[model samples]
Structure formats: C-alpha cells, structure tokens
Target: MPDFLLSQLLVSVTLIIECGAMQLKNKNYILAALSVSCFFNGFHYLLLEQPTAGYIFLFSSIRFLISIKWKFQWISAASLCVSLIITVSTYIGILSIIGFFATIFITIGSFSKNDRFLRLMMITGGSVWLLHNLLLWTPVGILVEVIFVGSSCIGYYRYYVAHKPSEP
Candidate 1:
C-alpha cells in the first residue's frame, strides 16, 4: 500500500491539474476521480510484474482533460473506454464487459443535456473501475462497487424516463 503522504500528494496534484476539480464541483466527485487515478498508478508501480500498465491511467487522464479543456466529448469517451480496457486486461483473467457498457452509456449521455444520465454513467464507470480494482487484488471490493452502481442506476433510469420525448 502507498504511504499516506504519497497518496495525499498524488491527490493534491490531481486536484490542481484538474483545476481544483472544478468540473466536478462536488468534493466527492473530485475525490473519486483522484482516488481512481491513484489506484491505477499504485497498482502499476507496486504490483504487476511488468509495470507497463500504469500509463493507461495517464492516457485516460489526458483524454479526460482534453475533453474538458477542448470540449471534445467523443475523444474523452473513447479515451475512457481505452483506459478501462487496458486496466481491466492487466488485472482480470476473465471478461466482464463493464467498460463497454459504461462507454456506450457515456457516449450516449454525452450528446445531451441530461445531467442525471451523465452522472449515472460516470458513477457506473467509477463503480466498474472499483470492481476491476477488487477483482485484481481484493475480492471484497465488488460488493461495495455493486451497491454504488445500483444506487446510481435508479437515478439514471428516472432521468431517462423523465427526459424521454413523447410520441406525437
């Protein structure tokens, strides 16, 4: 495990680069994003016999930043999928397809003003990322991840129905 100081430093750096995590005004969101980055970086450096997997987090972060900086949602979406797959491939010996589902949800959610749906997608993606983390080293993490995703799914479905256009 990374020392508390190192993790705090990493979180601080990520918060600064992501503009104090302004896009994610909620502190929880910022913490989640930074923590995910930390997990990937830590995994690559501490575990993993080869250590090439850490770059996946960097690529994903860059892609995420580009979307916010340049407003390229598609690029961000693609990068998210790529990063998810890279991380999952390294850890999981089996396929779960959570990345694919999350990406599709994100891509669809990105083109609209459905903030609720977008949040759901982000939460779902985050949950999957957590699950992937658990699958890699700690099997107990999946239960928590599932609860988080499930709660968000309810909100998402509600928004999807509310925003849905009606027939003529």
Candidate 2:
C-alpha cells in the first residue's frame, strides 16, 4: 500500500478512537482513548516525515499516562516543558512553534474538569493543527483536523448541552 493510504488508515482509526473518547462520561476512559489516539497520531506524523511532531505526540502519551495519577497543573506543566524541549531542539521555524502551543492546549484540555473548557481547547488546538497541516500539504492531517473540530462540537453538544436540565 502507498504511504498515504497507510497513514490515512491510521488516522481513520484515530478518528474513530477520538469519537469514543469524546462520548464517554468517565474521564479515565476518555483519557485512555486519547492516549491511544495520540499513539496512532504519532505514527501518522512519522509517515508524513514530521518526526518532531511525531516525537512531540509520542512524548505526550507519557504525560497522558502521568495524568492518570498527577493533577492537571502537573500535566500542563509537563506538557509545556516537553513542548519547549522539542521546539528548541528541532527549531524548524515559526510553523514548528504552532505545534508546540497546540500540544500544550491539547494537554490542558485533556486534563480540564470543565467540559466546555475541554471542548474549547480542543477546537482551538484543532484549528491550529488545521493550519499546520495545510501548510505542510498533508491531506490526511487536514482531514483529521477538520473532522476533529466537527466531532468535538458534536461531543460537546451531546455531553453538555443535551444533558443539561431544562431551565424552570
């Protein structure tokens, strides 16, 4: 199979896993699914020759694992630190910084207790990712970001808006 097809297949699976992650009521389960998604995403980036992005996500999975035990503040701090290390070491250009910030935003969202804040950060991160992928001319990356944004909105509605008690 072509590299694009293989990479896209991985992304397709990641999208499905992300959907499951978003719909769950249990935070642990959501994080577990997110961990899996991140792993697959790392491979997808590798296929795209964005090894720095791949390394960032692969390293991020460790933070997610730590998130299971540590507090949100710790996770966010770890994420930021990792981003700085990756970005500084790689130093591709301005575009590389976008991935770093996006990683931090995603880490914050993943650990946040607030449902709305989680989705908002997800949308924000996804938008930045969309721009990055577009700049890289990565079709699969572009598709994943677009779908992720739409899925996040749906997840937010289902988990928050739809479940809210009707006002008196």
Candidate 3:
C-alpha cells in the first residue's frame, strides 16, 4: 500500500478509537483508549514525515498509560520535560511548536484525577492540533482533531455540565 493510503488508514483508526474515548466517563478507561489512539496517530504522523508530532504522539501513548496507574506530580513533570526534549530534538519548524504546547496541555491533563479537567485539556490540545493538521494539509488529521474537540465537549457536557447540582 502507498504511504499516503497507509497514513490515512492509521489516522482513521486513531479517529475511531479517540472518538470512543470521548464517551467514556471513567478516567482510566479514557486514558487507556487515548493511549491506543495516540500510538496509531504517531505512526500516521511519521508516515507524513512530521517527526516532531510523530515522536510526541508516540511518547504520549506511554504517558497516558502510565498516568492511568500513577497520578504523581513528578510523573507529570517528567512527562513535560521529556516532551520538551522530544520537541526540541525533532524540531521541524514553527509547526513543531504547536505540537509541543499541545503535548504540554495533554500531559498535565492526563496526570490529573479529574475527568472533567481531562476532557477540557483534551479539547484544548485537540484545538491546537487542528492548526498543526491544517498546516500539514492532512485531511484525516484535521478531521480527527475536529471530531476530538467536538466529542470532548459533548462528553464534558454530559458528565460535568448536565450533572451539576442545582445551586439552591
């Protein structure tokens, strides 16, 4: 199969997996699903020749899985530091900056115990990634980010907003 075709296939799988994560109310399950999605997305970016995004996505897969079992502040700090190192080492151009910031937001959110905050950070990171995808002209990537943001928002609303106690 052609690289482009394979890249599309990878990202499409990522999109499906990530979309499933949005509906998950359990933090650990969400993290697990995201880890799988990130793994696939890493390969997709690599095939597109975007090393910065690719490496960050690959690292994120491990980070998300680790966060599911450990919510230590040190872990979050180390993840951020490692993300910076990856971004710097794989520096492609201005686009890499976007992926780095997205990774930072995602890493912090992933380490938190609050599911609402996690979804919020996912939305923020996904929005930033939207720009990166646009710049790269990856239609599947752009679609994934858009769906990620929308699904995250819906999840947030369903769990946080809709269920909030009525202040009397």
Query: What is the C-alpha lDDT profile of model 1 across 55-161, one tens digit per residue?
Result: 44445445443444343666656665675666566653332354344345544433334455555655756565565646444322333344445545554454455
Clashes of 2: 0
- Model 2 RMSD in angstroms: 2.8
> What local distance difference test score does each model get?
0.46, 0.77, 0.91
**Residue 137 Cα positional deviation in candidate 3, in Å, after optimal superposition:** 0.9
Q: Pick the candidate with the highest TM-score.
A: 3
Candidate 3 per-residue C-alpha lDDT over 1-168 given as tens digits, one digit per residue, 9 for 90 to 100: 988889999999999997778898788999999999999999999999999999999999999999999999899999999999989998989989999998888898999887777888889989999999999989999999999999999988987788883421
The regions of model 2 sitting more than 4 angstroms off are: 165-168
**lDDT of model 1, residue 136:** 49
Error of 2 at 144 (Å): 1.6
Instruction: Write the candidate numbers in order of decreasing lDDT.
Output: 3, 2, 1
Off-target runs (Cα >4 Å) in candidate 3 are 165-168
Model 2, span 33-61: residue lDDT tens: 77888888888877877777778878777
| Residue 7 C-alpha lDDT in model 3 | 96
C-alpha RMSD by candidate, in order? 7.4, 2.8, 2.1
Regarding TM-score, does 1 or 3 come out ahead? 3
Clashes of each: 0, 0, 0
Models 1 onward score TM values of 0.45, 0.85, 0.96
